[model samples]
Target: MQASQLSRVLVVGASAAGLTTVESLRRKGHTGPITVLGEEPHAPYDRPPLSKQVLSGAWEPERAALRTREALSGLDAEFVFGDPAVALDTAARTVRTRSGRDLAADVVVIATGVRARQLPGQDDQEGVHTLRTLDDALALRAGLLAAERLVVVGEGVLGSEIAATARTLGLDVTLAGPLAAPMALQVGPLVSGLLADLHTERGVRLRLGTGVAGLDSRDGRVTGVRLATGEALPADVVAVSIGAVPATQWLEGSGLTLDNGVVCDSRCRAADGIYAVGDVARWYHEGLGRLIRLENRTNATEQAAAVADAVLGDDRPYTPVPYFWTDQYDARLQVHGFLPADAEVDVVEGDPTARRFVARYRSEGRVTGVLGWNMPKQTRLRRQEIADAVAAAPAH
Candidate 1:
């Protein structure tokens, strides 16, 4: 079906990706009916701020709104909030909701995103929390306000950010993870080592290089985190920032490929008339010659645009240089493209000691990624290198 030929569009998961798909379709001159199904009762809101601004009380919950009420109303899309999609029939292009409503559309875009992974017995503990949704952030903020000491499990981006935000909010925060340093797997050793210093200098304790055993609770309230080495770190509140898994439970029997996420073609199409966007999509990357899924906020809109084009009968492959940014303490880190664990990183611009620099990552003699620390403009300029490298890469 062509753009104008699409009779009705159904977007499952009304977060950033789903909402953007709706907006993009309309912007691209598709006047056909659009319906967005969301699991959350709230309108589509940004998720990045939930870990920092919302958690620190710096920004009101409403400030994270991706679009104002008037803007959303102007979109002319029917939004069914709080109705989670429970089942999908790819053959019929129909989605059955938890509320027993079957929404059928000519095209169905899956943007259900991912849910935060939790430690064992996390839900049974009162003080143990995971920061994924808006409600989780608010509840954690409230808990932090009353707590004195906080232990953040999993020292990745989310865990590090949560520790930074909570520490800024006057909580004695300790970050624990199995990695050698925070974001070790993401940004690699050199930068993650610097992150360790940053966290320590900011009074955030680091309990790295150890795996979490479980939560120790008293009276159904979390008291501390037990490490694999039999060491325990006491906490008034515990935040688990372990990774997340793609939210594809509803599509289990839908006959669509589901690996770490909904596997799709290079154009983000899972099947005929069915596509996926955002973190829920593990689409083939022609440039990298592999299936990749990005969990950052940027992918939500970028992939949505790609899927929108695909739905409109555009055959261009949806290959993009992945991008993500993180703000912790006084540092803002930006990354473009892939950063393999063994990638050789070099200071391309500015000095690392100054905490304002750009690092370029190369693997197998090919520029694969760029890292920017507090230099957004220069980093963006350097991003062209990654783009050029991606273009030069031979497709499989």
Candidate 2:
């Protein structure tokens, strides 16, 4: 079926990606019928703030709403909130919700995103939290407010950010992770070492280079984290940020290729009339010559636009420079393109001592990534270097 002839489009996730798909469709002149199915009752809201602003109490919950009520109503789409998609009939292009309603459409977009991963037996304990949804962040914030000591498991972006927020809230925060330093696997050794210093100076205890073995609890309340080496770090509260797995379990028998996420082509199309976007989509990258799924906020909206264009018969491949940012204390780090762990990094501008600089990452003498530490403009300008390099590289 052609784009103009499409009768209905069903989006199965009311996240930034899903909502953006709806908006992009309207903006691109796809005025046909559109339906949005959301598992959460709340309207689409921005998630990046849930960790830093919302959890820190710097921003009210309402401030995170992606669109005003009137704005959402203006989109002219049917929104089915609080009903989770339980299954998909790929052949019929129909989605079955948990409430036993089957909705069929000309095109179906999966933007269900992902669920936070927890350590074994962590969920049964009280005072243990995972921050993925708004509800999770609020609950964690409440726990942090009443707690004195917090042990954060995982040294990735989410865990590190939560540690910074909790420390700012006057909690004695201990960051535990298997990596050598905070964001070690992400920004490489040099930048992560600097982050280690920053967190240490900010009074966040670092318990790195050890994996969390399990949770220590008594009377159904979490007490601490047990390290792989058998050392126990006591805490009044614990937050798990190990990572997240794509929410694709419901697609188990749906006949779509599911490997870590909903596998899709370079166009983000999973089947003839179905597409996948956001964190739940592992789409092929023509430039990288492999499948990639980014969980960052930027990819959600960017991929949504790409999928929306595809739904409207745009044939261009979705090739984008991956970008993400993290705010810890006074430091705001913005990264563009790919920063492989083994990539050679050089400070191209500003001074690292002053904690304001733009660094370039090179792999095999090719500019693969650029990082900005409080140098947003310069870093953004440096993004073109990576883009130019990618354009010049031999197609894989």
Q: All models: lDDT?
A: 0.94, 0.95
Query: lDDT per residue, candidate 1, 1-396, as tens digits?
Result: 788678999999989999999898888888989999999999999999999999999899999999999999999999999989999999999999998999999999999999999898888889999999999999999999999999999999999999999989989999999999999999999999999999999999899999999999899999999999999999999999999999999899999999999999999999999999999999989988889999999989999998888999889998798899999999999999989999999998998999999999999999999999999999999888889998898868
RMSD of each: 0.7, 0.7
Global local distance difference test of model 2: 0.95
User: Tens digits of per-residue lDDT for model 2 on 1-396?
Assistant: 568689899999999999999999999989899999999999999999999999999999999999999999999999999999999999999999999999999999999999999889987999999999999999999999999999999999999999999999999999999999999989999899999999999999999999889998999999999999999999999999999999999888999999999999999999999999999999998887889999899999999999999999889899899999999999999999999988999999999999999999999999999999999999999999988887788888
Looking at model 2, the pairs that clash are: none
lDDT of 2 at 297: 95
What ranges in model 2 sit over 4 Å off?
A: none
Q: What lDDT does candidate 2 reach at residue 219?
A: 99
How many residue pairs clash (N, CA or C atoms closer than 3 angstroms) in each of the candidate models, in the order given? Answer: 0, 0
Which pairs of residues collide in candidate 1?
A: none
